[model samples]
Target: MNIAITPFFRTLGEVADVQIGPFGSLLHKADYIAGGIPVINPMHIAPDGIAADPEFSISDEKAASLKRYHLEAGEVIMGRRGEMGRCAVVLPEHAGMICGTGSMKIVPSPEKLIPEYLVHILRSPRARRELENAASGVTMLNLNATALKGLQISLPPLEEQRRIAGILDAADALRRRRREALALLDTLPGAIFAEMFGDPRDNPLGYPARKLSDLCSRITVGVVIKPASYYVDDGVPALRSVNVREGGFDLKDLKYFSQQTNDGPLKKSKMKKGDVVIVRTGQPGRAAVVDEEIAGANCIDMLIASPKEDELLPYFLEAFLNSDAGRQMALSNQTGQVQQHLNATALKGIDFITPPIEEQREFTRRLDEIRRAKENLTTHLGELETLFASLQSRAFAGDL
Candidate 1:
């Protein structure tokens, strides 16, 4: 793709006026069921594009106040805090939406800039670096309207801008297709789980139903007394509450514990090859199967699990525990005011149905196949994302 270089590069503020709305304005959180107004927050702008999260909504009163900063179809919205530089172009479908204080709205001067072109530029890595530099705060970072308005941006001719955005848009479409394929890949395991076990709550599979404790030899919470300073680079791999993924441990970035710390509790929490690890806090109901690679690793305070049983397969149990049914059970059992937690006793009481060993093995086999497919799709998507980033980088550097 060939892109013409502009006579002169300029700052975005020089070509377009930045519109700053009122400060400290609050929007009432709206429920998805109520179907009132859609409120845009930093989280709503995903890495790929705008995502429709059910959690985003605004009350009628707050919606009325947002009329002042009402988004137009072609304007761009960017997060100013936490996820700074995350940008999205407002489409007609999102015209009536309101943005929170954490996001800044940008409207380009129509004569000098194309909205789609500006969106592409803002999403580039260069713009992200600028936004990160502008962000300020000790505990939580934030970007002010003034800093955003002063950020530099290169400008091309209007015709060139449209052509460049067109090429990028095509690439973006391919990226979205890969994402949809990945989503479908994820759904396969859930579908297979539902087919094999039926609903655990309804017990339509005609399998034996028992409380989780009845099947396991032992179940316990993880070690908590270890200090943060006790963590080392290569002493012994320690599983923090965050290590457990949906179906297994993600050992990509495991923490290490020092030899000086007491290994007594660590030994007690030491996971076996077939044991199940469930997150007891933070993200509840998240569970994983402990494989041989992490057989001797100890789990942190945020996780708990059960020893492997003869009647049940660890992989099957992990899949079931991470399903929608398991999440509901964990949520109901959770107890806390600010941070919710599930103790070993509560987790033990959760009931699940177990199929025959042959059927369990069959289910696991099918799940493994689906997971392999998903892994392939995920790898392809990652490659595509890298290609997209490279294009964006080159595009902004006047080499597109």
Candidate 2:
């Protein structure tokens, strides 16, 4: 195959019309009306596509006033502020919606570029890097229409563009299916919990009610005094409220504390495998178990619950804390005028009906299987992403 790399690079402005979204000053909160035209903002530009927030919409009357911002099918909507390279192609369903204050519209010239191919090009890592480097802002990066329009692309024949886009679309679809599988697996643990124990709210199983303190050996708060001072380049990992997900941990942006600190002042906050850590403030009931990966980790501003092991299992407690009834119980007991936080006292007092130890073990067994499946699916999804990225690089380099 002959590799063609010459006489193809063209500025985006030559192939597409780039226009900034409406200014914040032009769209006020008061202009938003329920059941109105959807506004596509930076947050709305999700990995799959536009995830519109109903609250951030404008009335048809309000949308009419900003006619220039009206979207047309086949146009690409890109976020102009904060994270760069977030964009989605407007489908027929999205037509007539308004572009939001933090986004911009890119209308590709059909003869020069197809919307599908253009979306892939802009979403590529190289394009994202260019946008990030060119964006300007002191606090948060912002993309200007001029800079966006000036971006260059290795233009290919329409037939070749369609072929590459089709290949990438297929690979992306596989990744999406894997992701959907993982999402479904995530819901399994909750379903099992409901089936085994019934809703904790009603205790339909007629299990005996008990405070969390009665089941746990101890309940306490993690290191809360000047935790920032213990930051180190690399040492014992420290868990924070941000790291706690509903039923797992998000290790991204994890901070480390000196081992000396972990063994000394923060020793009380040290977590062992099977320990449960709950969020203290923002997103108050979210919790996760301390797995072997971060078994000896120390935490900050989290409520640590050590299961008796003989009576209760950490996995079971973690699942319950993430359940609907558990969340409501946490929220109802939360105290604080400014931040509404769940403290050790509040967590210890939260009541739930205790199931038999044998039943608890059975529930944890099912949870383990679901989580293992999720891990395998997650690994496959990552591999598919790497393959898709390679295809994007090659296709744009005129090598595919």
Candidate 3:
């Protein structure tokens, strides 16, 4: 319907009243006589909108007392803290759900604005920027009930709002498809590993098995005495524990350290091309092969492996280290009361199967081919994701 923009562009306070629940009331702790009522929190509202899953639950008894805050099928709910300005329209399927104190419900007067249209407006960049500016806090920013209600939005006709939302929705779907494709690609390596080697625990292949220490000449922790002040724009990059991700190293976000830092521990911490870097602390067993570019880089206290034979490919070892068997071994050996950590001494004892030299080369070659194909697919997906974001930016800015 072609409603005037002036009437539709009203603050949330003008359209509906802000309701508050009892102090220290937990949404999940509420009583529900019928069944479990879905409780919405900041975490429940994803960047895309309403998440497919709910992290918490609530009962019907406590929900009844906060009836004013109860959401209808089309009411908009905005998170007021943590992830500020995240908004979602309550779906018809979620009619009985209750929202937490960190969320504020916006009941639109239907004559002026449509629920889905208002949701898009609130989630747009312009509206989010304004919310960020008004949010107050030292550690964690929060948009109070008053600030949320008083936020302004430029409204277009209901039909125009619907059209804009439709375009953005289509773009968002494309982005999701790309993400799904990338996830599928990640499964290929694991599947191949299982088929060729069988379960590492059971060792169905029954090849000659040896501890990691037997196959490698050296396995030790990286440097730890280096100072942060030695880091420079163009100097030797120090691979801290955080620089490593599950599949590979992220050189793009690397921190540099001066080559002259002389921290006494540099002798044991130098990384070579054929070395396998395994995370010993947080996210145990996560590892990656050091590529040629980062061959001489100094590593932190994380475990580094230097294999004794050219017969064993570093990539193949990395694949195994990231496998289910490697993770289980690392987790078992980890020590600590509060935060567990894996040490080089424990890692050396983890068992792995080794085929003949020729067979290892053949396996590595085939694995590389599969990884290259996955990389190509990932590249295309990233392009599609970028395109979708650009489309969203233009559509919301009224350029579309």
Candidate 4:
């Protein structure tokens, strides 16, 4: 049951002190020193934590002059440029870092607001929308102390706030752990491939090698689907480069095909199980094999190759394409000025040392197990993410 308790709304500035970073002129590029105080910029403030070894730093003397911008533990450091409401708390170890021009810091009043609780509210969906709506700029979005302080938040008793924060933190931890497990599982296939065949570039194992195109029946690309042909409920799955993860396909953001669609750009490009799809743009060169589940799916702007089972299996082909040497070959031959590309000819010319089909198949058996485990974790992670979002929604609405 959802319970909506009336919450006392309070402006952020009423309970916390907001301060923007130092003026840009005060910290110029020439003022940076090798060993000195690290500067925290918008890019350095990640959701995880403050980045170590910040690109620019100031001398001891300079840090003293800009000491007013120094961050403290429990204070929230936020990006003043790009992605409106992104903020991360400063850890104890990062206490003395200087806030760069692109950041702002919020110090909550200990008697009125808990820093952890404040951070949770600031990162919530409601708060993000408010922040984005309140932001202003021309080329890039921006946040100012006035805008940050004017945003209002629903306040609960200190104890209740802590309780809500604790529950959310625990849920977030589980989600993060599942994500880490998925990452580890994702790497196992690459590790096994390396152990079996060695690097495609060096060919240290002396396996018979050939041009990538030589081991394939045909190398082709998907057509660019126009806006009119895109649909969701009543068409074929349209896989784009974004849907292609390094070792797997991400089915989350799929746009579907139309009656005129399967007949258009993707006419003969319909995916088949074991067909290797390599990203031709965006995150270029990343490759994954088409699983049976999406065998008949149509794709767009991706390099597709039907591996010759007689010479090279699909598993080896994917592993090699993602291998360091194979990636280098694809990147070197890429075309296009703004959006880089890996055309069929360029992808075909990639060189790789081919291991025997038996050895490749043997490694693939273990590889498949790891992939299955990762997929399971990914599914669980998705559920946890949904739960986390639901919890955040309820907690802020005074239902938790």
Candidate 5:
């Protein structure tokens, strides 16, 4: 590596202290209490910031016992395992939180490096590549404090580092605003549905009732295969439970299957436009209408509910499935304790009151307008992501 390429290059260990969270031996489920000191686990660290409330918090006495693991504001916490490089900076309000197992901490010396710059460097593509190389695991990836300390980082003068961090932060803020706008948009359809039909279960309007089996021609499960069979490019699109959302589909993490792998299962569960796809596991009850864009895409562990258009439209079915009543009905029939699941047979039994076809059509027509706006915002978010990636590339390579 060219040492003179930038102002200075140093191993992270040289400029900051890298520490792991408390070991599993120190924490136990029994010690957790309500409204206690928040614990920072892998789930707590997010792109936005440390979650205000984590899944589990410990008693004040227990927290004091684990005082060595207390977090400090301006320090960074990151997942030591799973999606290796995920991290966030702690704010003053979260300074007292205890860093729990499955994460590590990085405390940058203020005189040597800025905390914002440290988070940016860790999130950049260069750091992610290095993190992947350092991680070790057969199933879930793992990162240790030693590996993090050894990460080689390029450091410019404090002023320049702050400048780059500021630019990135501004660009990030724009993306965040666009995301917030999109998130608000995501709720619009559900709001509209609730306004028009009220709750699906209560049916206070006294609309005609119909079982899902009567409205849907078929409610079939998707193909099942090993993760290794999925590809990044040039194959049939394969969606999983991860793809289905309440009001929309997430195509970002889509997988692909080759003809060799697709010959049998793919032929069986082929989807069609207007099919209402419902997740059977990993967040059961979530559903979305399959548009032309992903109509023929093969899915895994999801229910393909092909609605009878004469009685129920794809848009209306999707809205109902995502409503409060529909979610309750779906959840009730769900089996499996750890990973709740919804099979086709159970789903077919769900009773829902159908609105007048003409009314449903009018509601769908109005919904189309909102969806178009959300699509534009989603596209804008994608552009922002691309722009941020490009900026990070140049900033670190000393091209900015």
Candidate 6:
């Protein structure tokens, strides 16, 4: 059953006070200091909430100069650049923090709008689409105070707004817990590695160390050619730095290459099962093994290591490279002053302990078990996300 109510509407400007953050010229690089007030930027507006970096904090003197930019409890902080729908409510602890150049602050009138409800509405898919349409810029979408203020908002009675917000909050809480559980599951593989083989740096078991190249048949870079020029609507998927996670592949935002490109220039970069793809630049040192599902996929600017089955298992080598000790070794070999990267030559020279093939196989079996559990949890999380989206849609449609 559905109940329909004629809700009065108002422009965001009428029901709230909206203001953009300080201009870039107002807050220079020198203004930033350690152990000071944190600035809430677009990048800091995470999916979970605002994750302020202390490194971007400013001193009290600097903050006082920008006093008008300080955040207050219950206010909404929204990203003004890059992606739309990036927002979070300022909590009690976040009060006194400064707004960043890439953000905007919104304080809704309590009599007309509930801050939580407004945040929920702004984060909804429809609102995001409206915002994207209202935003300017072809390459980087941006929202100005005028654009934000002109946006129309549905204003149901106060109690109805609370009802919708409460329902959405409960659903969102479930999703958050599901994500937290998945994160906990992600740590199991590393823990297993630590328990079986002590840190490679310490070599507590006194395992013999060997050059990474000695254990691999081939170590090389992925397609160095400009891969974007070879993109196609449908063909072999081309993995990039974004596709690789710390211990796994994200597989989102993947570009594709035409079959012609795959057979021609991309032939050398075509991956096979058991090969490892390591990030080269953005987030260096992260590596993940190529499973059968994506065996024939191509990659761009990645470090590919084809481990010899006799000397080192692909899973074992990937775990080593992603381990704390392995990351330190990789970092030591990092090149490039502006953007640190791990080249094939540097990766080949990395020193790591050589565990017995039988022990490596045992670890692989345990890791496979953990992966299966993760897959199940991941599927459940996907379902929860769908349910939340549906709830948001219904709630905003006056169908809840």
Which candidate ranks first by lDDT, i.e. highest? 2
* Candidate topping TM-score: 2
TM-score of each: 0.80, 0.89, 0.84, 0.83, 0.78, 0.82
Q: Candidate 6, 326: how far from true, in Å?
A: 2.4
Return the TM-score for candidate 3, rounded to 2 decimals: 0.84
* Model 3 clash tally, residue pairs: 5
Clashes of 2: 0
lDDT of 4 by residue, 288-369 (tens): 9998888988788888899998888888788877876667766774352322677888877767678878898898898878
lDDT (0 to 1) per candidate:
0.74, 0.88, 0.71, 0.81, 0.83, 0.87
Instruction: Give the winner by TM-score: 4 or 6.
Output: 4
Model 6 C-alpha lDDT per residue in residues 162-222, reported as the tens digit of each score: 9889999898998899889889978887888999998988899999999999989888888
Worst 10 residues of 5 by lDDT: 331-340
In model 3, residue pairs whose N, Cα or C atoms come closer than 3 Å (at least 3 residues apart or on different chains), thus clashing, are 30-59, 31-59, 31-60, 32-59, 32-60
Candidate 3, residue 341: CA error in Å? 2.3
Over 176-219, each residue of candidate 5 has an lDDT whose tens digit, in order, gives: 99999988988888888888888877888999987889998888
Q: Give the TM-score (vs. native) of candidate 4.
A: 0.83
lDDT winner between candidates 2 and 4: 2
What's the ranking of the predictions by lDDT, best on top? Answer: 2, 6, 5, 4, 1, 3
Q: Give candidate 1's error at residue 259 in angstroms.
A: 5.7
| Candidate 6 least-lDDT 10 residues | 331-340
lDDT of 2 by residue, 1-400 (tens): 9876343889899999999988868898778877789999999999788888888889888899999999999999999999888888899889999999889999999898988888888888888899999999989999999999999887888888898889989998998999899889988878889889888988898999888899898898998999999999899989888998888888888889998889998899999988999998888888898889979999999999999999889988988888887777866743523336888877888786789999999999898899889989999999999999998877666566
Of the candidates numbered 3 and 5, which has the greater TM-score value? 3
